[model samples]
Target: MRFALNHIAAPNLSLPDFFTAAGELGVTAVEIRNDLPDVLSAWDPAQVKAEAEEAGVTIVSINALYPFNVWGGDLPARAEAMADYAAACGAKALVMCPLNDGTKVSFDSLVGALAAMKTILDTRGLTGLVEPLGFPISSLRTKAEAIRAIKAAGGEGTYRLMHDTFHHHLAGETEFFPDWTWLVHISGVTDPDVAVDAMLDAHRVLVDDADRLENVAQIRALLDAGYDGPFSFEPFASKVHDAADPKGALKTSMAFVSAQL
Candidate 1:
């Protein structure tokens, strides 16, 4: 299985340092967060592309565009610009997230957004990886919903669902979509005492035996069910940033996950 590291996993590191560390850890790809310290958004497209190529790292996908379904006016232009940036950075896809404030965007609106985004993606030769957030406030809560929206938008080959373990658990979804899933974000919630309702992005971290969430088991099931995609680390735990050696922490986490595979 190919391994990719998310920039959120080591938020303290610079882009060059993150790439170097990922390379040292034998990771094949790295995902960048637009909201993070070092990102493609901060650099010129050419420079970003050159830096990634020189570091020998591939850009898996841009972290996300929030409330993508409610986008209007300049949103399409912004998405197009981001897609162009991704192309310049040698990225494979753009991760689009749904509204998470319980605004109740209709399924038809979601389909419309996907169709609009797919048009932009097709024009830029990029793929749209739609990710559904499972938080109570989130409008979209399952990969199944995302899959249906993609199909409804007539984006069969242009778009795919991002299967996130944390959200899958939060959304109470038990089924897997091996054929339509393009990427998988693997992270676990370690605190059992922390109520599931209160869990947020901050609870994310590398999968471990102590995790209250069945992350490893879920991943195994996905693999067994024919998911042939990269399992990227997307830990949002603050400890990852506070650790003395983030690369060492990543190595330890990778070892743990690899054993399960």
Candidate 2:
């Protein structure tokens, strides 16, 4: 299992401490974020690159540029800024998320957005990991839809899918796109009372015996289908963020998931 950690796993930690935690967990790959802890605002790209080098950890990605499927407004500018920051920080990719406000964005708009973003990504030698948010209100909710848009935009080499297990369940998608996927975000929802559609980021937590998201099964399926990539932890619950020992909790969860496989 190639395990990676997102800074959301411990939003309280500073970038230096986050990299140390990843090393302690025996993981060489990690994903940083522009939200939550917001490492981008706290440190310069040179500092990020230097710290990552000192820690001997790879900055797999910057967590995201949101509402990226809407090609206009400040999105074009934001995308370039993010891509520039990602390149400067030595991050390998930039995660791109679509509009999740329950509004309809046309297919033409989606493809157009990808085509525009591809240029920004291509110029910086970065891969855009297009992640579909599976919220019922989300404009894009499945890997299949993302792939179709990517292909329509002629973004075959410049883009890849972010196969998020939580979103996969929420979207009710039965098909897997292992070949098109380059990264996987894993988290669990342990609240048994909440209906599937009602689950949100607040409900996400570390994977455990009580997890209802079928993370283990999802991981097995992806791996068996030849998706050789890192499964990065991305829990967004307040409880996880407030944990006194986030690394310890993550280690336990990692052990549980590994044992299951």
Per lDDT, the best of the predicted structures is 2
Summing lDDT over every window of 10 consecutive residues in candidate 2, give the lowest-scoring window. 34-43
Off by over 4 Å in 1: none
lDDT digits (tens) for residues 1-261 of candidate 2: 799999999989999999999999999999999888888888899999999999999999998899999888898888898999999999999999999988999999999999999999999999999999999999999999899999999999999999999999999998999999999999999998999999999999999999998999999999999999999999999999999999999999999999999
Candidate 1 residue lDDT tens string, 4-49: 8888888898888888888898887889878865485577867766
Question: What is the total number of backbone clashes in candidate 2?
Answer: 0
Superposed by TM-score, candidate 2 places the C-alpha of residue 36 at a distance from the truth, in angstroms, of 0.9
After aligning candidate 1 to the native by TM-score, how far in Å is the CA of 58 from where it should be? 1.0
What are the models' TM-scores?
Answer: 0.96, 0.99
Question: TM-score of model 1 relative to the true fold?
Answer: 0.96
User: What's the CA error at residue 245 for candidate 1, in Å?
Assistant: 0.5
Error of 2 at 257 (Å): 0.3
